[model samples]
Target: MELKSHSPFIKWTVRLLKKALYIITPILVVSILVTVSYLKQTSEVISKSQNEAIWFVLQLTKEYSEFIYQLQSYQLGTSDYNDMLIQYEILWSRFNTIVNNSLVEHLHQFEGSITEIDHHFTYIKAMEEQLLQLPRTKNESSLLLLFKNDYDDLQIYLNHKFRLSSDDLGNKINAVSTLEIIFRYLLISTILTGMIIAYLLLRESRYHHRLAMFDSLTGIRNRLWLNKKLDKLAKNNQAFNFYLIDLDGFKKINDTQGHHTGDIFLRHVASRLRQLEQPHCFSARMGGDEFAVIELIQLNTSGATPSLLPGKLVSLLNSSTMISGKSLTISASIGISQFPTFAKSIPEVLKQADFAMYEVKQQGKNGAAYFKPYSVSTMKNNPLSSVS
Candidate 1:
């Protein structure tokens, strides 16, 4: 009964947790998916940026190499001043194109790679007048050598910058990958936690269900369970014997020896009643000092009469018990009712059994009686019989 009283709170708590899980689980999943997608996009963008940086630097190096080749051809008399000047102009144009491009602005973040390129371009531009006079000036070979040295230095610096950019991009990719892994783990953990909570809730729900169906103190089926079973049997038109047993002298036990002793005595009585259980035989505690039993008539193929079972019940319950180191004795007044015989419905059968039990109590208790329809009206007029 204590557990039964707390059932409302337990049910409310379980419902609340279920609703929270239902709402939170989807939000967490969507959040994890969004985060992973953003990280993937970020990785792809960094990779593309690194590739563009590398390609840009390589293109500058190739243009400078072509310009050198043209200068060498002019010095060897294979190309004229016009050809060399055109190649030089093409190289300058290429440099200006890269400098004005948006990609170069993004490359500026790569440890000053663009700044280095700008410095090299400024130096070459300052020497432009002398270079255009190549194959005509007497200092052509010296100028060519100086230009080659500057180009070589710029190539080396750009190569180093590319390496730094590659390393930085790789670290960024790895960091993003690590973040994706972490979020995946968090998602898995959240799902597992939710599953565990759901399992525990199901288990707790079943536990409370058992608490509702059974007597808490005596560890037997309770009145609610008996009513359900009886209803099921009656609906199917299954014939069964119903026994309602009331413990005599129970209130005296509680008054003189305390409820603790009364409770102990009830437990012993329930244990004895449980011994009567068999195939198609059910026993339960209906409440304080009250118990019920059901036995299907069809299962009794041996043709055992209903009278024999009540006699056995009276004998078992009349036995003495040892509680708190003292010998205690108690008896029961049992009422017998049969389905489709004394009553056809659960309420009618129970009412008839209760009437018979009251008659037993009026006759001095410690006995059993079958329900008589005519006796019910007379018993109802009298005040309820008290526990001995």
Candidate 2:
């Protein structure tokens, strides 16, 4: 015999798995998000600091280049260049600002720049003191020739410093690249972890939701879930088919066969009900052997149920057979209640179905019944081709 599968356990496992994922997903997401944010801020800081350093170095190089170009006309032998002294003092002041500023953090590192800059100015300062005694308008081309030599000497030293500073900048840029790579990898790892945690968190959420709404024993919607759905349906003012199926003589199975056998019977019955072809049927456990199915779509209300399909709901219970040996027979006394036909309220509808189920047992066993007023229910108790 092909053994029947246990549905409640399978459904519960699926729900728990989903819930677990929910719990873990968010933590991963937030962590990755935080990492990406930190990396962006760090990259900005490093870039800004490096820019300030490069700007200072370039400023000194520009000033030195200009100073060297100006010296091309100077002669040092016979003339004192009075104008050159004023220009020299101004350039020195500017270069001092570059060296002394707090923005340039490491100063000793650029010693070549400092010494060469001062050497040229020291000689110019001497020239200026002497210029105070010479003619102002004369060309020092002959006299300036010596000044040119000292200036040339300055240029060679400045050039070497420029190369060193450039190398330093290149190395710093390399540092930026390395830092960027590290940040990128960190960000990637953070994102991956975040995704994993976020997934777990989401699963946890769903699992809790399932636990809240489902019966652990029967794999059917619990009372809480049914109430919620009923409220929604009522608010929408929609019509649906409702059924109450009570397994006849289930206590006999429990008492004679043991509780485990009863559980197996319940699982067997629940599993069979789940395989019904009706798309709109949803089953719920109203505690114990009482189970309910709600046909959310057009119901099998062939007898003029408003906005619902026409068909008797009798086969719903008859269609499922309990697992008995090669073929154990499971029978249900199905009571069907409809919207408007029974009562408009959810409670009233369910009560009518419950009442109708016992009504069949009163008449006879092995039959389905529709709840009708005691005065008018002539419909046979034996299961008929869906209530036409």
Candidate 3:
């Protein structure tokens, strides 16, 4: 029995799939990691910006309120003019801080907010001298009223800007969250797809292994399996008898009944051989209409000896089978060879079995023979030697 190699196309396809898996797996992992890292960084930046904007606006509003409180206290004669001026200076410094601050500058870019704040600063600077001379002016109340109106306007502007900034930040956070969800699902899908591909590849590999070791048409162990078993038994120095069975008149059946019926007949034959399988015996399809069986020879324990297997196989194969509504009768010529006895090597054992089977074919069509060294001389006399 000889083992056949896989087709070139099959080999190439498997290699290509393996390479694709190797390449795609790492890329998928990297893509998932990068996407997650980017999302995290973006979220952190947005959060920091939100916090800074909120803190800046709150502090500015608080300083403006304190300045107004000081001015009112001075008008009521409860605080000195120096205190009011000091609060005004503090408010002016807050405006200057907004101008120099990077985060505030970024916020100002959103809606020309920088221009609006600059206008307010210019108006405050124009009123500064009058505000300083407020205690001696006769119309101090009117000036105070005007100043309060301006303060209200500034408060309104700051509130509006804060709301806008909050809404914008909220929208960005929502967008980022959506993107994160999409990326997560994409990552999961990619992982699942990779698993499925890996599972399919594993299944395909197992199928190829089965094809290499078993006969497809007969659904039985193949020549490669038989060869492996022979090697193992030979290595262990186990005494066993190898039987090579060839169907007689199989070609005539194929010629008369077509190949389809012949295939059905062969399957039936293989099924019969399967019945011989046990702990001590194994059967395999050797190719075409040839089959082989190995039976371990136990000299002490015996219900049926190894020598009786050939006769049993001959009887089993001789039984008539119904195929394509026709009764097809076939017989077998079995050749017997012993391991580590008459033959020491695998090739020699197979050759001796083949010779003995051919000798059976020579002696009429349906019989069995044991291999003997002297039988080699009778090979030239048999005309049917080259038929198979």
Candidate 4:
């Protein structure tokens, strides 16, 4: 029987690992989704900030141009100089906000931009003070007329500056959008890749677990599985018959015909044993030329013969097999031991059956025996009469 390879610590460690994978898979997916949502929100905030900066600078330039128009009209006696000074003061405040505000400083930080804006504000302040002190005269009108051409040229330059600022805003927004798309794609791909890897690992673990429970050569329950079955039955207080079988003269055939023929013979024997399939009947290949069968029976029967099943199995093994265009014949010596009758437990039952099979092999090579507390009658001798 195969003992469990994992210690208690190892088993718990493996179980914890499986549970951690289950827990982390969902967390990983949720984290990716949250990251995508966060990035999207960040991109929108950045775009909003850029739009605000562009709108502030353009609106400030437009108001400053209007103030220049008011100043020029005051020289023609069509506008009050006080009104022109108010507009100039408002433009100065707006320009100060755009240039000094931290939020849009990056957009306005051109070479000598602060010095140039300060020069404009200072010239406007000096003109406002001088106009307040002068009498209304034609000499003053000529002085203002000379500055009209400079105001027109400045208007043209501000319009071009607003257009360039708008274009830069668009490019920044586009770059932000592209980065968001790439980040979202990368997060989704990482989630998908993790899911695939976890699924494959789970499938491989299940496959190996299944392989460990069955015989690789004969495609039947192995000794470990049979032992586990008997243990379960014993736990349930169920009574069953344990048949231990050893193939007779199988070694002679294997020695002369090679292991290929030996494998064929073992498969044929396993197939024949499986033919005894019925409710509560199971067969197993217990390594090499040894095999076993388990059959559930009544707890306490009157005058029941334990050797009846072994006799049937012996007859089954005596049948002829054809492999590789050559006929082969083999016989088996089977021993019967009843659970809770000859032995009280699973391991004891198997040991008793093993002893009985050895007794049969001792008496003759092709017969069956029942393990008993006292000696019993000898089974009829049916040796391997032919092996062709």
Candidate 4's residue-wise lDDT over 80-197, tens digit each? 8778778877887876776666766545534344455556556565566555664545345654654455455555654554453555545656766776776677677666767766
lDDT of 2 by residue, 203-288 (tens): 65666677778877767677789788777887886677676778777787778777877887777776666665266667777788
**lDDT for model 3, on a 0 to 1 scale?**
0.77
Local accuracy by lDDT, each model: 0.79, 0.60, 0.77, 0.71
List candidate 1 stretches off by more than 4 Å.
1-41, 51-90, 93-105, 108-130, 135-165, 236-239, 271-281, 296-312, 340-342, 359-364, 367-388
- For candidate 1, the clash count comes to 0
What is candidate 2's CA lDDT for residue 141? Answer: 52
Q: Write the per-residue lDDT of candidate 1 for residues 137-171, one digit (tens) a residue.
A: 75668878988999999988877767744666667
How many steric overlaps are in each model, in order?
0, 45, 0, 0
Query: Candidate 4: lDDT of 100?
Result: 67
The list of candidate 2 runs beyond 4 A from truth reads: 1-105, 109-165, 180-195, 297-328, 376-381, 385-388
TM-score of each: 0.68, 0.66, 0.64, 0.60
How many pairs in model 2 have backbone atoms within 3 A of each other, for residues 3 or more apart or on separate chains, i.e. clashes? Answer: 45
In terms of lDDT, the poorest run of 10 residues in model 2 is 305-314
* Residue pairs in clash, model 3: none
**Candidate 1 local lDDT, residue 110:** 72
